[model samples]
Target: MIAVRRSETTLFTSREATHDNDTVALTHRAGLVRQFGSGLYGFTPTGERVRRRLIDAVDAELRAIGGQRISLPQLNYSGIWERSGRWESFEGEMFTFENRDGKRLCLAPSHEEGVVHLVDGAVRSYEDLPALYYQVGRKHRDDHARNGLLRLKEFTMKDAYSLHADADSLDETYERVRAAYVRLFEALDLAFVVAAAENSVMGGSASEEFVAPVETGTLDLRHCTAEDCRFGVTDESPGWASVGGICPDCGGNLVAGEGIEIGHAFKLGTRYADAMDLTVDGPDGDEWRVHMGSYGIGIERLLHTILAQQSDDAGCRWPDGIAPFGASIVPLAYEGAIRETADRLYRELGAGETLLFDDPGQTIGERFAESDLLGIPRKVVLGNQFRETGAVELECRDGTTRYVDPDEVAAVVSGTRSGD
Candidate 1:
């Protein structure tokens, strides 16, 4: 039942940035997002719908693995970070401020320190080991944020931390979370690579990153071309993407490309545990440090990555699972049998996140054009086709059209969920 006149929509146009990435331009043109500052944006209703769908998909995967959802404060006391030895490391890059009482605080760039502090006193013995907790919240940093959603000063992240008593437990949970990330990207219909990576600020021994290959990415990597080989590496790795660009495993020539890093996981054996002095009573009645691991996925980066890879000159082509609306009804006229049939279909099937109707006084051509720009997966026209015959014209994002009964619209659109 959500209908809007295109003229009344508060969509503002945006100018291109230094990188010349058109996602910013196209997204603004579609009325999905607006920029208030250099890397800060406000999501319009249409953009927020897509963002919600993406988060829902991620949350479902997290809950499937027994993850306890929690919320952490965005403002954090600097004392905790000082204890972790990261205060000096993040000196200029963190948003730090001091109050009149000389109490120092900073906007949280990541919550590893905060999360460890929360679990510091909750459990006391080995039996309380292997705790898995996660939170979806805003993370802030003062770095040079650019390139639309790929890089931002403030962005949303789904960060999960697990506390284990032994390396075996940590290894098991790390692999589980990695597999869950694979499922998440697959659900979004994105082709991605899980590459061996360095644990830069997120310290650990074994680390990996989930990267999506796109033209607008800044991270460099070389991948193997062998059918069974799935190896990928960053430029920081020694002999990685070597002068000959040879694959280490199969000795085949490698292909170099840039990728957007969407998710990162680290096997932090005692990084945080030792720093925070967190320990538990072991089976031998001795104090033992807890093994820890952290995993994170950028929410907005996923949205922009999908647009960078899946869009064409015509406009974006939203994957069925992440599309704002599953379908749209564009009737040729606003009156007579056309409106009547459109209304009936809207009531029975177009309700919820399923449908939208462009009912402005513009011509049918304008309505169809805007539908393409919005990237709606499916479109139904209750025009002369429905008035003359009982068949409604159905149009797909691919420009294919078909005539079907009004009653069949729901089944056809709902069936797309399976393929998505």
Candidate 2:
């Protein structure tokens, strides 16, 4: 069992409030991340644990959809962007500089041009079409990063691109990817909506965004009033006001709200392939421009959105699969039988799956408060109850408490206790 002492990491649970948003406040208070500069932050140990789990979950979903994982370089030659006719358009937002060798290099904000160039000569036949490649890496931008993790100059992103021989093939892969995204968000239990969005710099035939509505969000969204209808549109779309405040699919009234965008999918068509001269020979020996689609999930933005939507005034309350630790073992006093029981329970529950609060310097109240702030799902207490009656108390994040025998604590916390 991975036992973590309260004194190991500097927690800001008792620190003074420094931010206006409670979500951002709790993020710092719980020791999730630390800022180094404007728009730049580093993840703490607990933060890295949660971040790694998020990446693993995203990777699993993409791999299940036949996406081959590959790494793309973050630094790219400016010539590719020039060939794609986007260098001037993206100059204001992209990070470009001249290397010592007198060559212009850029920290890519997106990989449309780079990916096409990477596979330029590799895809020479129609059979090689419909290739789906993806990567989870760092992306750079020059925006005024603020609002905690909502906006950052540099962030992690999971981006996938698909090359197809025809529009029909592209459409099929796009829908599959859309479904995969739905599954992922639902698994996280996020109240998100898919909305038709503007292509903007990506310049695609069509695109959609996964947005989670929150009071602190900045993206304006118009969603259907009907509970069963999921149609919505973002104000970024041109002529959005012409919709007459109605859902085109169900004629339901539309309501406006602010939201944070977590993911986006674009049907790029032949924009990048045509610009970069990536083509595949058809079965009839004719050269045809490859169709392309790209999908992106903002890793840090999604994490921040989760905190914004799920956290409360007390602290964060992570979802089932996303919590950094499954359970925390809080012994009222780390001595004698109490410590022995806590250690035994930690062993039974799997050390890696549980965190033993073994620090003896703090009072019991402090330990309990820290556990709650960390959003641990279950808190097993070995206090007077255990000493008097041999009954252990299991405290859930929702404020529910129950007593169970020592042997049953694991099953009860895991929801595998047979009797109920």
Expressed as tens digits, the lDDT of each residue in 1-420 for candidate 1 is 464434556433333322377876678766677777987877888888888888888899999998999999999989899988888888777899998889999999988898888988787898998888998889998868788787888888999999998899999999999989988887787867767877777777878888777776868877777765656676655445444578777898777888888888999889988898989999989998999999999998888988888877767677766776677788887677777777777766645444445446669887777777778788888888888887999888887888989988877766754223
lDDT of 2: 0.85
Each model's Cα RMSD: 2.5, 2.2
> Which stretches in model 2 have alpha-carbon errors above 4 Å?
1-3, 12-14, 415-420
lDDT against the true structure, each candidate: 0.79, 0.85
Residue-wise lDDT of candidate 2 within 326-389, one digit each (tens)? 8889999899999888889988876447778888887889888888888887889998999999
Where does candidate 1 have its weakest 10-residue lDDT segment?
10-19
Choose the strongest candidate by lDDT.
2
| Cα TM-score of candidate 2 | 0.95
Residue 183 lDDT in candidate 1 = 84
lDDT of 2 at 156: 95
Candidate 1 at residue 175, lDDT? 90
